[model samples]
Target: MNLKNLAAAALFAAGSALASLGVPHAAFAETTKLKVGYLPVGVYSYFWRAQDAGYFADENLEVELVPMAGGGQIIPALQSGALQFGISDALGVLNARKGGLPVTYVSFNFSQSSDNPVHAVLTTNPDIKSPKDLEGKAVATNLSYNTDWTMMREWLRKNDVDIDKVTFREIPFPDMLPALRNDTVAAVGAVEPFVTFGKEQGANVLGHYFTDVKSPVVLSGIVAMLPYVEENPDIVKGFVKAVNRAIEDFKADPAVARETIGAHTKIPATAIEAMNLGDWETEVPPSEMQFWVDAAEKEGILNETDDLNSLVWSPKE
Candidate 1:
């Protein structure tokens, strides 16, 4: 199913109107307008909350959240300056920097918590009990050389499954169901809502892949060009401030999340209501980041010559 469907203003307005959703206000004397691209999925509830609660405005940021289909277009938009900032996975940012995109991750969007998993490996075949069972099988991933692919490889290797033996098929999240049903791919690496939806459709969940590899896995976050960040550190701070506030708003009330996610993704109310939303935070430790960078390097998604420091941006207190 297509995660993003154009929705009306009322859904967005719902967050701002809710009385229980409250966070400290950020004040800036000068307003800076920013155009940001986001996936418009439940994973990006913080972005919608930031917009819905006027946190961006409080931080003197007139933000425009451009709806993006996936990571494929987000970085390119940032590179060409079409977007001042965009949400993308760690591996995408690492590979982009390896390809000379000059981008750095500025904030954390979501990560794998013990209570909630952002991704899972699903199979229609019940015989495939473990990663090793799918030794020579074709697995579907949304992107051929992305964070999910890297994580899948690592998770497989840990299970003694030969990484070189498995064939990966690139399929969009929406088409994964059909692909699995038609036996196009033996298994699919699916993210939230889809994981739940896949289960609802009778697909056997192998396990939450991230948890199988490592706990507290950092999945994705906000990113922007390094040069832009250095030149306008305050803007970065303002944006991050808004994100932090949005995180609190989400934690404060469950209804705010339901409304914001429903507004942006247009996923069915039942799915949205039942979806396991992971932790939304602004801090991703360097050690946690090293795991993805190492995975990217091992997967050849990043060049050995690439420097890790340039690929990340941490705000100063």
Candidate 2:
């Protein structure tokens, strides 16, 4: 073959090899602009910290932060395929899964669930003391039978208070304080941003329940629709890796949390110190989901999760 023909033949073979190897052509591109939902609160430091520091950008992820009233409502959005990803309390994910909401947690966001570590039980009437004091009284939470209720049950058990003795109500964290002032509920179980706000309103801090039974409760964590996961598997992997990076960033310098205050949550820089944002490790310990299963089961909230194992998923290490 002449030099010109030989060169053309070599170029054709090279192009064919590249195409057969599944490598994208120069024109091929990844889907851009992800729609990620988050509750309007300060404890979601990892999500905010990640966005603030451009960790998502570094990973080639362009996340659109969509704010919702609370993580509980994120289920419907996820179910209808309106959201690509979001952070949700573990209970929300479990309950939604049972309800066939088509979502699951990809990583642990808040590692601990003591009522006080990142949240609080508030009572405006200082006369009330202990979980037993909640008897015959109404209480409010941003969501019912989810985080606060789970936390309340743990606190009640810890304080030797009967869970059946109290009347529980649902109120948004923003509305919880107002409900407390209006006598809608005697006390309100609240977490971050709201915890600080509730306390500032002269609401007495009754008790804090971080874990279900003094065990780590995986409160708010990241979950995604399985279809979305299957559609963009790399997005899921990149997102999780980026979260670990964000957590490391926050763990090393908590100052970034202050910057996230206005964007992710309404709380100020001064309040960030008081709230406990656990270590930013991406691991969702298999033991963590146990806290939710045990708590929800014992509290009579496990209507759909009779078998704990069925409701749990441990990502491969």
Candidate 3:
């Protein structure tokens, strides 16, 4: 009884020690890593920095820095599961929901401040002064009458600037600066990172609206295909933790954040922080989303609708 029992106990102790060491044959598999997509813009500075700085490592995510050509592909890629998540504007998310797209917002990248100052108006025409002055002139925007166009139009109408009196042509953002210098577009909308770049080029920053409109009028956030979120809540959860770390890093050691951002985004950190850079956090204040939806409805860009439940997506607490 004594010899046999002692031998069994020793074997059991050895097995327990091996188990504690996490033997591959018996241990649970590592979590599946995530490949999130993002654009190289100041709006996503934290995300870019976080990817480079290994912020997602703790969350078990291996971030893939996707340099998006534009939002057009990002949305479709999300739909097709080509991307686990993406950083894109509120307008694009709204349009996707309105059109029955299957993607859902995981968290807001930026949505907190009155002086946030997005979409700065850089006019080439020295004669055209304020935002009000651009009414009669032709404006160039990457996506006309879609994004800042509604707000621009509203600001124009409120200030008695005739909407029909002006014309709009779609021009890529980078091209606008050269176009401005060459006397092509009288005025162009330049959001952060680009705004600073435009200013450096000697373009007159006539006006900026994000400084006033503290609403969700403009936003770029984390979005994942609904299926991905459903299939892997853990991945989404990790993304939040990673971004949260990055956000704190951005505010705390801005110098380090800039270095990280400059490297990943290919946009200078000085240029990035100097622009109309707004808040970058996890808050998705309902009031902000209302601003975009209400503004769109008021401008007739969207008919009367009520999908607040689905239109908005915030991180699950």
Candidate 4:
């Protein structure tokens, strides 16, 4: 089904579920309205789950989950006050901070670990057996300087592959598989659902790039402008609490998670069922932030370092 139809179905399902729970729509006398921007992907199922299950309502929040194309679009919207909050990769958030955007991560979202690797380097070429084999070949990522691209570059670098010799192409997640199939790109740095899709299409995984760098690294999280967070600390805390509740629900019920994911993302049920959903965390540790900080410095993405503590938002006692 198309994305629009799937989204409609998801909303209908959410409404039905909420109705069955006997939760009236006007239960709360005072509700904080929020516009949260996020990329439409399976990993972001927590947002949909939270909204659908009345977790946000339980926190007295009326959230409008805005589906965005990428961080590029989301970041600008957040800056222009079009969105109150946005979900972004750790790298993107750090980069934004370096560029002087007062955004801080309010809560962690998705994580990648060695045991449950959710991101992979997939290639259809028979001769490309390892990372080194792609030294002179082209690889596709959703975007340059994105989490996938940075992790893939680090993985290739650690594997003794000359990354300078490798050509990087920015193909959207949905287009990566076709790019690989047609040999438009030698390989693709793909995340879940797409990783499962690529394997189903006979593509071989060269490696789980993110895990290769470090097991259990924070990939992305929910971010908000510092000013908004400071002014509305209660709203930020409520958002984190609601999402944390949803994350717990997501972990406890895999079937419902898949259904919610399939309804929101364009991935088919078969691939969604097969894909590894990876890990979710409510807390974004300072060490995890430092890992990206060190990485950015090494990659010359950041010249001056910033305080890691300041990058994350916490409620004042």
Candidates sorted on TM-score, descending: 4, 1, 3, 2
Local distance difference test, each candidate: 0.80, 0.70, 0.69, 0.86
lDDT of 4 by residue, 93-124 (tens): 87888889988888866887888888999999
Estimate candidate 3's alpha-carbon lDDT, on a 0 to 1 scale. Answer: 0.69
Top of the candidates by lDDT: 4
Write model 1 residue lDDT over 28-123, tens digit each, in one string: 156788999987678887888888888888888999889897667999998888899999988787777678778788885577766788688999
lDDT of 3 by residue, 1-317 (tens): 69999998887777778777874322333555566676676667777666666777666577776778655678888888778888766677767767778766777667535556657778767788766677667887777535566666665666677878888777877787888888787988766677788888787876664444445443667877777777877778777878888888777765765576567656765685675556676665555566777777776667755556555455555
- After TM-score superposition, what is the CA distance of residue 130 in candidate 3 from its true location, in Å? 2.8
Query: Total backbone clashes of model 2?
Result: 10
- Runs in model 3 deviating more than 4 A are 1-31, 112-118, 215-218, 265-273, 304-306, 314-317
Candidate 2 residue-wise lDDT, 36-68, digit = tens: 888655566677777778788767788888888
The per-residue C-alpha lDDT of model 2 at residue 133 equals 83
Off by over 4 Å in 4: 1-28
Worst window of 10 by summed lDDT in candidate 4: 23-32
Better of 1 and 2 by TM-score: 1
